[model samples]
Target: MAKKQDNTITWDTFSEGLWRENPVFVMLLGMCPVLAVTNSAINALAMGIATLFVLLASGTLISLLRNSIPKQVRIATYIVIIATFVTIVDYTIQAISLDLYNALGAFIQLIVANCMILGRAEAYSSRNPPLKSIVNATGMGLGFTLALLCLGVVREILGAGSLFGIDLFGPRFEPWVVMVLPAGGFLVLGAWLLLFEWLKQRKSETELNPASES
Candidate 1:
């Protein structure tokens, strides 16, 4: 369906990734970092931004070179391109803040293997112009980042009584403890998935019977 388009930039192309086709929430791609590194809002935000950068950079480059590349070697080329950007992010993070760098750990390097960026390269960028690809990548990256924040913010607030390390409640507030654990990632992600699913279903019903919403 995407290939059928004339590669024009439209709001749908950008907004689809933010909601309708969100990489994390809707498509469930790149769950590794989504669940592993999102225990805190800061970590989630940092990871989201990093992924967004890689996506935008790699997508733009891939779109420019798409026509010249052999179809058989495209995937390898995509990975190399993605890895170059990931390396830049990984080192930049390390130089900026060792704490954040350690917090994210190997997951930063793993962005190379993230299916979300590669999928965009193969599916959207390769078939579209650079401008359209940039718009699409921006939306998709934000969507993925938003999904991470959804899980991270809730988990951090409940688990640590904080948001981005700021104490929200007080010393009197007892943290959930579990919210910061590996298990917390699963619980939060599950709850979010259910909520999004319900919302989607409700939207479908409303669209099918417009009067019902009124």
Candidate 2:
């Protein structure tokens, strides 16, 4: 019984963040970056990729040293490891493109302070194996990215009448300027949450009365 209870599957760890415990939509852990950079699809994509890299790297390292880390300073130690990855990502972005680096700005460095990363480090990775930790981190990162994209798409389309900086609608379309503003972030997020809840309820109803549908 002990053995069975203690065991975990790698795939389970990876899939949990997809829907069951999504960092952005479900868990709502890292809102700062999500709301700040999601005005455009490209910005959201850049932020997502940068976050994914640091999360996987830090989670792997932290899991590898879980047994050795002193309980007295585990939080501090995790911060250092996370900061190291953030630094790497920061410089890499700067080297790649000055414009992108300027766009993402301090949010890249602020990944160290993102509760989602640290939460996963302490809650899942620290207790799991390196492979499991990386998988879980990847799942969570992907979930966050997907959520960002959802908002980015809607805002970019409505606010700028474009996607990825290319105009989808001709000059006749009037963009909703508010969609690009900070308030648009809240509005979009709230709409998503409402949709998620509605779908969840529909699923629940289907499950509760499966015979009727058949």
Which candidate achieves the best lDDT against the true structure?
A: 1
What TM value does model 2 have? 0.93
- Name the weakest run of 10 consecutive residues (lDDT summed) in model 1: 205-214
* Native-referenced Cα lDDT, model 1: 0.92
lDDT of 2 by residue, 1-214 (tens): 0122243565767777877788898888899999999999999999999999989999999999999999999999999999999999999999999999898889999988999999988887778888777878899899889888999999999999999999999999999999999999999999999999999788878796746532
Q: Residue 17 deviation, candidate 1, in Å?
A: 0.4
Q: Write down the lDDT of every candidate, Cα atoms only.
A: 0.92, 0.89
Q: Which pairs, if any, clash in model 1?
A: none
What CA RMSD would candidate 1 show? Answer: 2.4
TM-score of each: 0.94, 0.93
How large is the C-alpha RMSD of every model relative to the true structure?
A: 2.4, 3.4
Q: lDDT score, residue 213, model 2? A: 35
Clashes per prediction?
Answer: 0, 0
Residue 58 displacement (Å), model 2 = 0.3
Model 2 clash pairs are none
